[model samples]
Target chain A: MFFKIIVFIIIGIAGGFIGGMGMGGGTLLIPLLILFTQTDQHLAQAVNLIAFIPMSAVALIIHIRNKLVEFRHVLITALPAVTASVLASLLSKRVEGADLSLYFGIFLMCLGVYQLVSAIIALIKKKKSQEGKQSAENKRELSENRQD
Target chain B: MKKLLKKVVVVVCSAAVGFVNGFFGGGGGMLLVPLLEKVMKCPVKKSHATAIAIILPISIASAITYIINGYFDWTSVLSVSGGCIAGGAAGALLLKKLPTGIVAVAFALIMIGVGVKLTFF
Candidate 1:
């Protein structure tokens, strides 16, 4: 029992770290719980949902203090978000756990591919800009030689 | 008309975000940030901060539903949440020090690897 708690904590820490970095910790957490802790999909999802509450609440307070939260925009989304989430959560209960986990796996892969492609694009852009700068410098040097 | 269209788009997208978050039990914030930045033209920092504000209430609503459905597990929740709070602080601090680009790449690879494992094995 004690050992299990330790394992759960470790998984939570990993998930929290990723989440704290704004990389979607619950995505990682749900998988870890399912794989390592033998948690079923629905339960794992439940754990991730509940775990996020306090952490987000704390972060929200800080963001509020910093005036980072836009209340007007939040209001616009929050109503729809809450309504949809409640409907979806209830719907999740009807889905089989294995099917849900399988779907989640596909979703994770898509998200990963999206992130990877975007990161590679950003890197390529950076390299291209640097190369452009170097070429411009070379052109200037060549013109200077012609002038001389 | 354009303004009305944009509002409608935001509403539909927000609904999608809520549905994803609720169905998956997380990941809504990831989608929300982009919507805010690209569609709504919110600054990156503000989008991230506001994402939490938006996700918080949605998560609370989902959590309540999950609890009512008998998905609650006290022991795991207590231990995991405790670790999450502690690790979240550490992660926030690490974010300032770490090169985010590299971290993002690594995280993406990990996600792919895990996803494959879950799907096939």
Candidate 2:
């Protein structure tokens, strides 16, 4: 019980960090729920969504106050995704225990890789763009000197 | 007019996310979270929560779709959610005590492993 509580808090913060970063926190939360709590996958997902409710609310309030939320943009994903979540939730239920775990594990493992790869790719692209801008600026300065 | 375009973008993007989410129960969030974090540059912790918040509406919408399609499993949702809350609380607390570096490293390793698995297996 104590271990479980400790695990939950840790997962929350990690999930919160990921959540704050906007990766949906489920990737982190679901795995922790499975590994630490020994919950089944579908149940883990349900728990993941349930835990998300309050956490998300608090996060949303902060974003709203900071003017970080783009309401129009948010709706774009939320409406359809929510609809999909229900369907997925239903479908997930029919999967047997081991199969559910295998699928969830695969999903998590894949998602984690995607996050890291995407982050790295984004960083590289950003660096290249910065370099391009700097080179352009230098060329502009050189041309201006020649004109002078 | 500009707002409309933005709304269109949202709808399109959300729809894409929704489609993927509907197809695979996990994706709406996985995609949304990073897009929000990287593109929006939302602060990590806050963005994490916000992603979930954003997912809430999307999840509900998807849930409805699932229900309409006759896929929703209330018993499963209830059981999982019940377990998750308790687990989530514990996970949240455990995070505070660990060194950030350790957490980061562990997370990174997991991400790398998962990424490889996804790409190959």
Specify the highest-TM-score model's number: 1
Residue pairs in candidate 1 whose N, alpha carbon or C atoms collide under 3 angstroms: none
**Candidate 2 CAPRI grade:** incorrect
Q: Could you tell me every candidate's TM-score relative to the true structure?
A: 0.92, 0.60
lDDT of 2 at A67: 68
lDDT of 1 by residue, A1-148 (tens): 9999999999999999999998889989999999999999999999999999989898889999999998878988889999999999999999999999988898899888987887788778888999999999999999999999
Q: What's the count of clashing pairs in each model shown? A: 0, 56
C-alpha displacement of A1 in model 2, angstroms?
2.7
Q: List TM-scores of chain B, every candidate.
A: 0.97, 0.65
lDDT per residue for candidate 1 within B70-110, as digits (tens), equals 99899999999999998888888899998777888898898
> Candidate 2 at B62: error in angstroms?
7.0
The complex in candidate 2 yields a DockQ of 0.21
Report the poorest 10 consecutive residues by lDDT, candidate 1 chain A.
Answer: A115-124
Off by over 4 Å in 1: A125-148
